[model samples]
Target: MANISQLSEEERNDIVQRLKRIEGQARGVQKMVDEDRECGDILTQLASIRAAVNSLNGELLEAYLLRCIQNPDDFGSPEKAVQQAVRALVRS
Candidate 1:
């Protein structure tokens, strides 16, 4: 297994930017509600936001598996880590 690796500054910045965009989407949804937009339109926006959040979750999970669970030094029991990861993903 590969050793655990820390996220580079650029990677961290990219994640932050993605999160900010998601935040903007959430705020837009609120505005739509306040404006009494069509239910269909609001629902569409909500679906888009959900997709973005799921995408973000996938990215984070990939990073965790690659940088933490794959590293024996970082994760004492890789099998246990995998189980935990799977459980969390299932719950999500």
Candidate 2:
């Protein structure tokens, strides 16, 4: 399996912290399963984790767009970078 790497230190830390929190949530889910906790409770936790992940992805994409693709003052450069980013993101 290929190991995906983070591109920036700040982003890496943010993601790592989020993952650690998710790990804790997973552990909690396991305990909930072991103890036969309510299905609704488990589903709620799962949904929270999914939402957190999606929010992180959105944050990273917005940051990339604003910092990398939107900063160029020259005409067409920013748009080109945006298109490239969109293609790369779609491919991934």
Candidate 3:
């Protein structure tokens, strides 16, 4: 949320649209489960969802780091920022 203020409306909308697609994919997975989808097919969709979430996390992390670097005073201590970023990257 830190660097979000620097984003243009178009950038924000792009992120929102990506999230919407992910939401749709999640719903599709739910429907597939309800229909008794093949295990492999369900697992494949789950993998895709994980990849999408990872991609979004990378994008947001890039934005956050850039903002913090461009405005360090607003980000608090450098150590805390590094800790937070690393924690996010290594999280399951």
Candidate 4:
């Protein structure tokens, strides 16, 4: 597996917080299931979690592109780097 660069402290914290919130939401969903909560409400929360995760993924990808692929003044192989990034992003 390719090693990813470390995130900034702020970015790291933000990701942790988002993950925590998602975790909590999942737990709540479990509780809802146990208590037989409204299906619509549970589904709504699940959808929200999915959207949040997708948004977080987009943010991380954007940061990676900016820092790894675009900001390098001496990429040595700029075309290859950009193509790789584009391909990865498209696959994502």
Q: Top model by lDDT, which number?
A: 3
Q: What would the per-residue lDDT of candidate 1 be over residues 1-92, giving only the tens digit for each residue?
A: 32223777787788889899999999999999999999999999999999999988788778766654556355557776676667657766
Model 4, residue pairs in steric clash: none
| TM-score for candidate 4 | 0.77
What is candidate 4's lDDT per residue for 15-72, written digit by digit as tens?
A: 8899899899889889989999999999998998899889888987877677556544
The local distance difference test score of model 1 is 0.77
Q: Which of the predicted structures, 2 or 3, would earn the higher TM-score when compared with the native?
A: 3
Number of backbone collisions per candidate: 0, 0, 0, 0
lDDT tens readout by residue for model 2, 1-92: 00135257777888789889888988888999999999999999999888877777777666655554545443257666667567647843
TM-score of each: 0.80, 0.64, 0.82, 0.77
Q: What 10-residue stretch in candidate 1 is worst by lDDT? A: 1-10
Pitting candidate 1 against candidate 2, the one with the higher TM-score is 1
Q: Tens digits of per-residue lDDT for model 3 on 2-31? A: 756578898899899989999999999999
On TM-score, the candidate that comes out on top is 3
Ranking by TM-score: 3, 1, 4, 2
Identify the runs in model 1 with alpha carbons over 4 angstroms from their true place.
Answer: 1-5
lDDT to native, each model: 0.77, 0.70, 0.80, 0.76
